[model samples]
Target: MTRESWRTRLGFILAAVGSAVGLGNVWRFPWMTAENGGSAFLVVYLAIILLVGVPGLLAEFVIGRRSQRNPAGALYRLSSGSKSWGAVGLFGVVTAVVLLSFYSVVGGWILRYFLASFTGGYFGSPGQYFGAIDFGLPAVGFHVGFLALTALVVVGGIRDGIERATKVMMPAIIVLLIALAGWAVTRPGAGAGLSFYLDFDGTYLRANFFDVLGAAAGQALFTLSLGVGTMITYASYLGDDHNLASDGSLIAVLNTGVGVLAGLVVFPLLFATVGELTGPAAAGGGPGALFVSLAGAFSQLPFGQPLAVVFFGVIVLAALSSSISMLEIPVAYLVDEFGLERRTATAALTCLVLVTGSANALNPGLFGFVAGTLVDLMLTAGLAGFLVFVGWVLGKDAVTEFSSGAGSRVRSLGPAWLWSVRTILPLFLLGTLAVNLLALAGVSLF
Candidate 1:
C-alpha cells in the first residue's frame, strides 16, 4: 500500500496549526499567565517559544519528513534499526494515548458547555452546574461522544479528514476569538483585567524567576503540541518542498497570538462581569472553576446567551483540533508499523481511549493526577527523548534535513539549531522533567 500525503502546502500548514491551537491556548494559557506575573510570564514564554519551541518542532519535522513514517518507524529506520531509539518513538505513541484519555474528558466538558450555552442550562447556578456534571456517568457519556467526533475525522484519511476539518476549524477559532476579544475589552471595568494581563511587574518577575520560567516553559511546549509525536506524524506526510522552519515559525506565532487573544477575552470578561481574577473561584482555580466562573459571567451580560454560544463554540473547535492530532499519533503508529487500515487503526484506538477516558471521567482523583501531574511528566520526558535522538542520533543528518526546502537565511542557522537541540535543549527539558517529578513526589523547589 502507498503512503498518504497532504494535498497541498496550505492544507498541511492549517492542519499543523490546528493541532497546536487547542485548549492549552484557550483554557490554560490565560490562567497560567495571570498566576505567573502576567506580562512577565508572557515575555519569558515568547522567548522560550522562539529559542526552544521552534527548534524542537523543526527537529521532529526533519525526522518525520526524512523518514516519511510514523515516529516509531521513523526513529527505527533512521537509527539503523536501533530498537532503543524506536522505543523512544513508541514512548511518544503512549504519551499521545495518555494525553487523549484525560484530554477527551475535558473535551467532553467543553462539548457539554457548548450545547448548554444555547439553552442557558447552567445560568441559574453556574458553580453548582459544573459540580453536578463534572464526573461520573454523565461525564463518561460525554467523553465517549467527544471521542466519537474525534474518530470520525481520523477515519477519513489525510486530505479529506484531518486537513479539511482543520482548515475550517482554525479560521473559525481565530475569527471568533478576535471578535470576542474586541467586545470584551470595551466592557465597563474591563480595563482592570487588561491591566492585569498586560501590565508587567518587574519585582514579581525577579523574585519568582524560576517559578515563572518553569510554568512558561511547560505551557510553551504544551501549546505547541511537541513531544507527543503529533508534529512528527504530521510532518511525515509532508513533501520536501515545504519549508519546515518557515512553517514551524508561523505555527508558533499563530498559536501564541491565539493564547494572548484568549487572555484578552477571558480577563476582561472576568473583571467586568465576575469582578474577580484570582482565588479559588477565579482564573487560577483550575478548569472546572474557571468554566463555572466564565459561565456566570456570560449570564450577566446583555447579549450573554449568544456570546456564551459563540465562546463555548470556539472552545469546542479548539479542543477537537488538538484531540484529532492526539488520536492520529497512535493510529499512525499502528497503520505504519502493522499494516492496519486507517479505519481499523482508528476504531481500535478509539475504543481503547473510550475505556481509559471513562476511567478518568468517573474518578476525579485519577483524572486530576493524569490531567495535571502525569501529563506534565510525559510531555516533558517525551520531548527530551526526541531532542536527544535528533541531536546525538541524527546529528549532521538532522541539519541536512532541516536545510532542505529552506532559504539561505534559515539554512544558515542549521548548525546553531542543531547544537542547541543536542545540548542546551535536552538539558532544559530534563531539568523541567526533574522539577515536575519532584513536585509530584511532594517536593517543591520554590
Candidate 2:
C-alpha cells in the first residue's frame, strides 16, 4: 500500500491545533494559573511556550518530516540502526499509551457531563454530584464510551479519518468556545474574575519563584502537546511544500490564545456565582476544582442547561482531538514499523488502552499518580530525549530538515534554533525534570 498524506495543509494545521488544544487548555491551564500566582504564572508560562515549546516543536517536526516515519522508526532509521536512539522512540510509544490511559478516563468524565447537561442531571448540588460520580464502575463505563469514540475515528486512517474529522471538529470547537466566553464575560460582576485572572501579582511571583517556574514549565510543555512524539508523528505525514516553522508558531499562538479564552470562561463563571475564589477551589487546580465550580456556576444561572451543553460539548471535541493524537503515536509505530494494517493497528492499541484506562477509572490513587506526577515526569524525559537526538545525533542533518520547507525568515534562525536545541534547552529540560522529581520526593530542591 502507498503512504497516506493530508489532503490539505489546513487539515494538518487544524489537526495539530486540535491535538495541542485539549483538556490541558480548558482544565489544567486555569487550575495551574490559580495554584501558582495566577497572572504571574500565566506570564512565565507564555514565555516558556515561545522560548522552549516552539523550538521543541520544530525539533520534532524536523525528525518526522525527514524520516517520514513513526517515532521509533524515525529514530532507528535516522541513526543508521542504532538501538540507543531507537530506545528513545520506543519510550515515546510507551508514553503515548501511558498518556491515553489516564486521559481517556478524564475524557469519559467530560462526555458524561456533556450528556447530562441536556437533561439537567447534575443541576441539584453539582459539587456533590461530581463527588459521587468521579470514580467507580460508572466511570469505567464512561471511559469505555470515550475510548470507543477515539478508536472509531483513528481506525479510518489518515486522509479518510484524522484529517477529515479535525476539519469539522476544530471549527465547531472554536465557534462554541468563543460564544461561551462571550456569554461568560457578560455575567454580573464578571469584572472581578477577569481582574483576578489578568491582574499581575508580582509579590507572589517573587515569593514562590521556583515553585511557579516548575509549574509554568510543566504546563508549557503539556499545553503544547510536546514530549510525546505526537508532533513528529503528524509531521511525518507532511509534504515538503508545507512550512513547519510558521505552522509551529501558529499552533503555539492559537493554543495559548484558546487557553486564555478558557480562563475567561471558567474564572468569570466561578466568581459570578461563588462570589469569590476560596480554599481548595482556588488552590486545587485540576478536574475537581473545574467540574465542581463550573457545575455550581451553571446551576445558579438562567439558560445554564443549554450553556452547559455547549460548554461540555466543546470540551468533548477538544478531548477527542487530543486523545486521538495520543492513540495515533502507537498506531503509527505499528503500521510504519511492523507493516500492520491501519485498522488492525488501531484496534490492537484500543484494546490495550481499554484495560489501562478502566484501571484508572476504578482507582483514585493510581489515577492521581499516573495522571499528575507520572505523566509530567515521562513527558519531560521524553521531550528531553527528543531534543538531545536533534541536537547531538541529527545535528547538521536536523538543521537541514528544519530548513527544508521553511521560508527565508524561518530559515535564517535555523542555526540559533539548532544551537538552543543542542545545549541550553536540554540542560533546561533536565533542570525541569530534576525540580519535578525533587518536588515529588518532598526534597524541595528549589
Candidate 3:
C-alpha cells in the first residue's frame, strides 16, 4: 500500500491548527494570562510567538518534509553515524506518552462536563461542581472513552482519521468560538472584563519580567504544537510540492488567533460577571474551568444550555484533534522504526496510555507535575534539540527545504532566519530552560 498523505493543502493546515488549538487555548492559556500580568504577559507571549515560534516551526517542517519519517527515524537517517540523534527523537516519543497521559485525563473531564451541562448536573453549586466530578472512577471511565475516541482516529490512519476529522473540527471550533465571543462581548459590564484582560500595567511586567518571559515562551511553543515532533510527523506526510514556510506561518497565525479569541470570550465574561477574575477558578478550574465556569455562565444566561452544548462540543473537537496528534507521535515511531503494523502499534500504545492516563486520573499532584512543569520542560528541550539540529547540522539543506515552495519574499529571508536559529534562538532557549529548572528547584530566578 502507498503511504498516506493529506488530500489537499487546506486539509493539512486545518489538521495542524487543530493540533495547535486545544485545552491550551481554552483551559490553560486564560489561567496563565490571569496569573501573569495579563496584557503585559500577552504582549511578551505574542512577541515570542512571532519571533521564535514561527522560525522554530519552520525548522521542524524542514526536518519532517526532508526526512519524511518519525522523529526517531528522521534524526537517525538525517544524521549519519549518530545513534544518539535517534535517542533524542525517542525522547519526543516518550514526551508524547507523558503529554497524553495527563492530556487525555483532562480531555475526559471536558467530556464529562459536556455531558453534565445538558442534565443540569452541576447547576446547583457551580463552585463545588468541579470538585465533585474532577477525579474518581467516573473520571477514569470518561477518560477511557475519550482515549478510545482518540485511538479510533489513529487506527483509521492519517487520511481517513486525522485529516478528515480535523478538517471538520477546526472549522467548527472557529465558528463556535466566534459566536461565543460575540455573545460574551454583548453582555452588560463586559467592558470591565475587557479592561481587566487588556489593561497593560507596566509595573506588574517590570516586576516579573524574567518569570513571565520564560512562562510565555514555553506557552507559545507548546500552544503552537512546535516541540513535540507533532509538526515533524505532520510534515513528514507532506509531498515535496508544498511550501513549508507558508504552511508553518499559516498554522501559527490561525492557532494564535483562536487562542486570542478564546481569551476574548473568557476574560470578558469572567470580568463582567465578577470583578478581576482571579486564580484558577476564573481562568479554568484547573482542567474543569471551561466546563464548570462556562457551564455556570450558561446556566444563568438565556439559551445557556444550548450555548453550553456548543462550547463543550467545540472543546471535544479541539481536544480530540490535538490528542490524535499526540497519539500519532508514538504510533508512527513504532511503525517506522520497529516495523510494527499500524493497527498493532496504535492498539499497543493505547493500552499503555490507558495505564499511564489512569494513574494521572487517580492522582492530582502527579498529574499537576506532569501536565504543568514536566510538559513545559520536555517541550522546551525537545524544540531546542530540533532547532539545533536544523540550524547547525542541516544548515544548508534546511535553507533549501525552507525555500523550496516559498515565494521569493519569504525565500529571501531564509538565511537570516537560519542564522538566528543557529545562534540566538538556541541561546535564548538554553537560558529559559536553566531558569525553569532552577525555579523548580526553588532558586527563584524572579
Candidate 4:
C-alpha cells in the first residue's frame, strides 16, 4: 500500500497547529507564568522558543520528511537500519502514551466544566464545585469518555479522522477563543487582568534567571508540542513537494499566536474575577484551574451560561485536536511496526490509555506528578534523544532534508542549524533534563 499523505499543505499546517495548541497553552501556560514570575517567565519563554524550540522543530521535520516513516522505523531505516536508532523511536512512542495518560484527565475536566456551564452549576461555590468533581469515579468516567472520543477519531485513520476533524476543529477553536478573549477584555476590572498578564518585570527575571529560564524552556516546549515526535509524525504525512521549513515555521508561528491569544483571554478573566493570579482558585477550584476559574468568572457575567458553553466547547475541541495527535503516535507505531490495521492499532492503544488515564483521574497526586514533572522530563529526554539522533546519526543527510524546498534564506541557515543541532542543542537539552530530574528528586543542584 502507498503511504498516506496530507490532502493539502494547509491541512497539514492546521493539523500541526492543532496539535501544538492545547491545554498546555491555555491552562498550563497561564499557571506557570503566575507561578514563576509572571511576565518575566514569558519573556524568557519567548527567547527559548526562538532559540531552542524552532531549531528543534526543524530538526524533527528534517528527520521525518527525510525518512518518511514512523519515528522508530524512520530512525532505524535512515541510520543504516540500526536497532539502536529504532529503540530511540520507541522511546518517543512511550512518551506519547505518558503524555496522553495525564492529558486525558485534564481533557475530562474541560468536558465536565463545559457541561456544568449550561446552568451555572458551580456558580456559588467554585472551590467546592471543583473539589467535588476533580478526581474519583466521576472524573474517571469523564476521562474515559474523552479518551473514547479520541480513539474513535484516531481509529478512523488519518485522512478521514485526523485531517477531517482538525479541519473543522481548528477554525472553530480560533473563532471561539477570539470571541472569548474579546469578551474577557471587556469585563469590569479587565484592566487589572491585562496589567497582570502583560506587565513586564525585568527585575524579577534578573533576580531569578535560572529558575525562570528552566521553567520558560519547559513551558515553551510544552506549549509548542515540541520535543515529542508529534511534529515528526505530522510531518511524516507530508509529500516531498511540500516546503518543510516553511510549513514548520508556519506551524510554530500559528501555535504561538494561539497560545498568546489563550493567555490574553485566561489571564484577564482570572484577575478580573478571582483576584488571585497565581495559586489555586477559590475553594471550588482545584487541579483543572482554568476550567474552574473561568467557569466561575463566566457564571458571574451577563449571558454567562451561553458564553460558558462557547468557551468550554472551544476548549473541548482544542483538547480533542491535541489528544488525537497523542493517540496517533502509538497508532502509527502499531501500524508501521506491528502490521496492525489503523482501526485495530487505535483500539488497542485507546484501551491502554483508558486504564492509564483513569488512574490519573482517580489519583490527584499521581496525576499532578505525571502531568507536571513527569511529562516535562519525558518530553525533554525524548527531544534530546531525537536531536542527538539527527545531529549524529543522520548528520549530513539531515541537513540535506532541511535544505530541500527551503527558501534561499532558510537554506543558508541550514548548516548553522545543523551545527547547533549536533552540539549545543543536545547539550542544553541534557543539562535541562538533568536539572528537571534532580528537582523532581528533591535535590536541586542548580
Candidate 5:
C-alpha cells in the first residue's frame, strides 16, 4: 500500500492551521485568559508562542519530514532504532487520545448549541439548560454524534479528506469570526470587555508571574497543537519544497490571531450582556460556565437567535478541525506501525474514543481533571521529550533538517534554533512542567 501525502503546499498549511486553531482557541483560550488576569495572561501567552511554541513546532516538523513517518516511527528511525525514544513518540500518540476524549465532549456541546440556535432552545434559561444537559445521557449522545462527524472526514484520506475540509473550514471560521467581532465591538457595553482584554496590567503580571507563566505556557502549547504529535503527524504528509520555519511561523501567527479574535467575540458578548468579567459566568465554571455565559449573552442581544446560529456554527467547524487532528494522530500510528488500512484504523480508534469521551461527558470531575490539569502536564512533558530527542539524539542532523527548503535568512538561524532546542527550550519546558506539577499537588511555589 502506498502512503498518502498532501497534494499542495496550501493544503498542508491550511490543515496545519486548522489543527492549531480549534476549541483551544475558541473555548479554552478565553476561559484561561479570564481566569489568569486577562491581558496579563495574553502577554505571557504571546511571548511563549514566539519563544517556545514556534521552536518546539519546528522540532516536530524536522522529525516528521526527515523520517516521513508517524511520530513513533519517526523517533525510532531517527534515533537508530532506539525503543526508548520511540516510546516517547508513542507517549505523544497517547496524549492525542487523552486530548480527544475530553475534546469530543466539548465538540458535542458546540454541536448542540449550533443546532439549538435555530430554535432558541436554550434562550429562556441558559444556565439551567446547560446544567441539565452538561452531564448525562444527552451529553453522551451528542459526544457520539460529534465523534461520528470527526470519523467521517478522517476516513477520506489526506487530500480528499483532511486537507480539503480544512481549506474550506479555515476560511469560513476566519470570515465569520471577523464579522462577529465587527458586530461585537459595536455592542452597548463592549468597551469594558475590550479594555479588560487589551489593556496590560504589569503589576498583575509580576505578582502572579509564576502562576500566570505556568498557565500561559500550557495555553500556548495547547493552542499551537504542540506536544501531541499532531504537528509531527501532519508534517509527515509534507513535501520537501515546503519551508519548515516559514510554515511553522505562519501557523503560529494564524492560530494566535484566531485566539485573540475569539476573545474579542467572547469577552465583548459577556460584558455586553452580563456587564462584568468575574464570577462563574465569566470564567470560573470551566467549559460548562463558558457555554452558559455565551448562550445567555446571545439570548439578550437583538437578532440573537441568528447570531447564535452563526457563532455556534463557527465553533462546530473549529471543533471538527481540531478533533480530526487529534484523531489522526492515533490513526496514523496504527497505519504506519501495524499496517492497518486507514478506514480500519479510524474505525477502531473512533470506537475507543466513543467509550472514553462518554466517560468524560458523564462525569464532571473526570472531565475537569482531564481537560484542565492532565492535558497541560501531558503536553508540556510531551513537548519536552520531542525537544530533547531533536537536540541530543538528532543533533547536527536536526539542524540540517531545520534548514531544508528555506531561504538564506531562515537557514542562518538553524544553529541558534538547534542550540535553543538543545539547551534553553528543554530547561524552560522542564521548569514549566515542575511548576504545573507543584500546582497540581496543592503546593504554591510563589
Candidate 6:
C-alpha cells in the first residue's frame, strides 16, 4: 500500500491550522492571558512565539518532510538506524497517548457543553454545574464519546477524514468566533473588558518578568501544538513542492489570530457579566474558569441560549479538529513503522486511549497532574530533543528540507534558521525545560 498524502495544499494548511487552533486558543490562552497579568503575558508569549515557536516549528517540519515518515521512523531512518534516537521518537508516540488521555477528557466536556447549550443545561449555578459534571462516571462516558468521534475521523485516513473535516471546521471556528466577538463587544461596559485584556502594564511585566516569561513560553508551545510530534506527523504527508516555512508561518499566524479573536469574545463577555476574570479555579487554567464561568455569563445575558450554542459549537469543532491531530500522531506511528493499515492502526490506538482517557475522567487529581505539569514537561522535553536532533544530527539536511519549496526570501533565511535551531533554540528550550522541572519539584528558581 502507498503512503497517504494531502490531496491539496489548502487541505494541508487547514489541517495544520486546525491542529494548532484547538482548545488552547479558546480556553487556555485566554485564562493564561488574564492570570499572567493580561497583556503582560501576551507580550512575552508573542515574543516567545517568534523567537522559539516558529523556529521550533520549522525544525519539526524539516524532520517530517525530510524523512517522510512518522517520528520514530523519521528519527531512526534519519540517523542511519540509531535505536537510541528512535527511542526518543517512540517517546513522542507515548506522549501523544498521554496528551490525548487528558485532552479527550476535556474534549468530552466541551462536547457536552455544546450539547447542553441547546437546552440551557448548565444555565443554573455554573460553578456547581461544573462540579457536578467535571468528573466520575458521567465524565468518563463523555470522554469515551469524544474519543469515538476522534477515532472516526482518523479512521478515514488523511485527505478523506482529517483534511476534509478541518477545511470546514477551521472556517466555522473563525467565522463564529468573529460573530461572537462582534456581539460581545457591542454589549454595555465591554470597553473595560477589552482594556483589561489588551492594556500593557509595564510595571506588572517588569515585576513578574520570569513568572510571566515561563507562563508565556509554555503557552506559546502549547498553543502551536508543538512538542507533540503533531506537526512532524502532519508534514510527513506533504509533497516536496509545498513550502514548509510559508505553511508553518501561516499556521502560527492563524492560530494566534484565532486566539486573540477568542479573547475578544471571552474577555468582553466575562467582564460584561461576570465582572472580572475568574482565574486560579484550577492549576494551569482549568475548565472551571473558562467553561463554567462562561456558562454562567451566558445565563445572565439576554438571548444567551442561542449565543451559548454557537460558542460551544465553535469549541466542539476546534477541539475535534485538534484531537484528530493528536490521534494521528500515534496512528501514523503504527502505520508508518509497522506497515499496518491505517484503519487498523487507528482502532488499536483508539482503544488504548479509551482506557487511559477514562482514567483521567474518573480521577480529578490524575487529570490535573497530567493536564498541567506532566504535559508541559513532555512537550518541553519532546520538542527540545527534536530541535537538538535537527541541529546536531540532521544539520545541513535540515536546512535543505526547510529551504525546499520556500520562496527566495524564506530560503535565504534557512541558514540563520539552522544556526538558531542548532544552538540558540535548543538552549532556550532547555532553559524553559529546567524551569518547568524546577517548578515541578516545587523549586521556584525562575
Question: Tens digit of lDDT per residue, candidate 2, span 1-446?
Answer: 67888999999999999999999898888888878877899889988999999999999999999999999999999999999999999999999999999999999999999999999799897777887888999999999999999999999888888999999998998888888889899999888888878999899999999888888988988888899999999999998888889999999988899999999898888888776754225634456778877877888899989989999999999999999899999999999988999989999999999999999999999999999899999999999999999999999988888888878888889999999999988999998898888877888754
- Better model by lDDT, 3 or 5? 5
What is candidate 6's lDDT per residue for 341-413, written digit by digit as tens?
9889999999999999999999999999999888888999999999999999998888888888978999899
Model 1: worst 10 consecutive residues (lDDT sum) = 276-285
Clashing pairs in 3: 285-289
**lDDT (CA) per prediction:** 0.91, 0.90, 0.86, 0.83, 0.92, 0.89
User: What TM-score would each prediction reach against the true structure?
Assistant: 0.98, 0.98, 0.97, 0.96, 0.98, 0.98
Q: Which residue pairs collide in model 6, if any?
A: none
Model 2 compared with the native: what TM-score? 0.98
lDDT of 1 by residue, 1-446 (tens): 89999999888888988889899999878767767877789889989999889989999999899999888999999999999999999999999999999999999999999999999999998889999999999999999999999999999989999999999999999999999999999999999888878888788889999899988988988899998999999999998888999999898889889999999998899889878644223433666866887888899999899999999999999999999999999999999999999999999999999999999999999998888878888888989999999999989999999999999999999999999999999999998888878877899878
lDDT of 5 by residue, 211-231 (tens): 788888989999899999999
Better of 2 and 3 by lDDT: 2
Clashing residue pairs in all predictions, respectively, total: 0, 0, 1, 5, 0, 0
Comparison by lDDT, 1 against 5, better one: 5
RMSD of each: 1.3, 1.2, 1.6, 1.7, 1.1, 1.4
Off by over 4 Å in 3: 277-285, 289-292
Q: Can you list the residue pairs that collide in candidate 2?
A: none
- What global local distance difference test value does model 4 have? 0.83
lDDT of 3 by residue, 92-112 (tens): 889999999999999998888
TM-score of predicted model 3?
0.97
Show where candidate 5 strays beyond 4 Å. Answer: 277-283
Q: Which candidate, 1 or 6, would have the higher lDDT against the true structure?
A: 1
| Alpha-carbon deviation at 57 in model 2, angstroms | 0.5
TM-score of 6: 0.98
Clashing pairs in 4: 126-284, 127-283, 127-284, 127-285, 128-284
